[model samples]
Target: MDLDRASSELNEKLSAIGGTANVAVLKSVVTQASSAIPVMPLYIAMVFKKMREEGVHEGCMEQIYRMFSQRLYKADGTAPEVDDQNRLRLDDWELRDDIQQHCRDLWPQITSENLKELTDYQEYKDEFLSLFGFGIEGIDYEADVNPNVAFDVIDI
Candidate 1:
């Protein structure tokens, strides 16, 4: 696929939101699946950079918080609501006041030079690595290790 054109088109759509948009570029740590794809990592990173510049970058935690806390409730504080198709309102949570406020506080302080130190991207990367038995902080990757997985049939 044309990564540049795709990325540009996505950014253009985001820009059309007029700064009132809650559009967030969802990214996670690199995984075996993503690493196997030729351009996935670079594409994700570029999209992340663009979204950051657009002040719409958000991590997984933020997305989860928005999903559960902001979208599940009814305006009358009674029954849960859903979309026209009855699907969960997952995408709208980033527009919440607290979430936006928190993002606003962090977004301006992020920079390319200090992205690792300043943003949760590093942590997300580490978490992603951990899923594949890598990138755990305080764990020695240089040492020999044993990796195993055992699943209980009934419980699992």
Candidate 2:
């Protein structure tokens, strides 16, 4: 992966917002992509739109919570799995009103922005590569996986 190209793309988009993006941050975002390509632009759009609507801006913890919660999100885009049972287990209490409102506000914008930016198959493939750790930092994937390792519980 050409980090220089990825870094340039990340800075270019951030520059439009009068902000600076560092390599570490870029690498983190790039690593999250499903493809090896830098997906910062898509992230920027998603984050900006979500911040506008959600009112409750999320840090990493909130991000993980929402993402994990939405893994079973419905086909109609509703929080199908975040029921009382889930809320009680996941949070200290039941599904709080504030949480519902936040999701209601942000989900639409997140969905719309992602749909808009990631509709292309080429882009999808690139994004997927990054998701699987292809474009991330501190990972020299050029060294091949040890094919000799096996699922065997003991030496045969």
Candidate 3:
């Protein structure tokens, strides 16, 4: 459901517990799948540069593909992601219609070599995760998770 509908439902549930209109409700978030990522800003410089120079600018899908095509593979017809981890990212399949159109529009004359460097999704996923302060280079996950800490600011 949409944000307003979810928030109203949340308020209704809170009312059942005599908790409606609590100030904390304003700060609470209903978990959502489409929250914006902060990492794209950092890559703006590179993306704009690529767009201007190579005329190859892309959003998440294309960028993921580009990552794969570049760092993850070479000229021959070999697919990796089928490695020991058995970690299969359906990034190619995840390329939505609009996104594919956007990519084609950006570089209508794309070459075979260009399309080959398609995605380093796992690496991209790691970079995306690190943006939320959860997976830093120095932090140790096993040593750290403090259960006593509440999930929200009010509880803290």
Candidate 4:
């Protein structure tokens, strides 16, 4: 997959954010979300691990807020720059030079033996399942907790 082109596109996107940008895009080769996708799981894991070490990560809400409330607005809050399709390109931050360089260095060195130590695969898997009410951290599924409750009703 055109790695150079991808890198260039990432850099171009990041540069779109002029001064006063609230978010920066960072490239990730792997994340919990991509674990199930074939052909690149190990690469993704290594990337995720590297990024975590660098303290660069953003969830869905943080990204959306930065897009409209921060990057899109001018200094005086008068206007937002948009393309012909009225879209704010937030993916640019991921292509920054430092991030790209780190990923490139890690790409060839990752292996199955060191995967667990380097990546947060198990942690991410737990978090992903917890979202759907499975494998929650504190609450025990096998506990005697009751799911049914009674509410008072009055007939008029």
Whole-model lDDT values for every prediction: 0.54, 0.44, 0.42, 0.58
lDDT over C-alpha atoms for residue 77 of model 4: 80
For candidate 1, write residues 38-143 as lDDT tens digits.
8455444444444565576666676666655655444555544554433444444334465446555666666778766555455446646777888766888799
Top candidate when judged by lDDT against the true structure: 4
lDDT by residue (1-156, candidate 3, tens digit) is 354455556668887785432111111111122225453322232233334344444555565565467424646745444323223333332244554454456454444455323433334455457557666778777896667865655754
Candidate achieving higher TM-score, 1 or 4: 4
lDDT of 2: 0.44
Off by over 4 Å in 2: 1-90, 112-137, 149-156
Estimate candidate 3's alpha-carbon lDDT, on a 0 to 1 scale.
0.42
In candidate 2, what are the lDDT values of residues 1-156, reduced to their tens digit?
A: 465466567768988886533322111222343223565455433443344354544434665565456433335655334332222123211124654454455445555436654333234335557656566658887887877866758766
- Candidate 4's displacement at residue 56, Å, is 3.2
**In terms of TM-score, which candidate is stronger, 1 or 2?**
1
lDDT score, residue 149, model 1? 69
TM-score leader: 4
Answer with 1 or 2, whichever has the higher lDDT: 1
Clashes within 3 Å, all models in order: 0, 11, 8, 7
Shift in Å, residue 151, candidate 4: 13
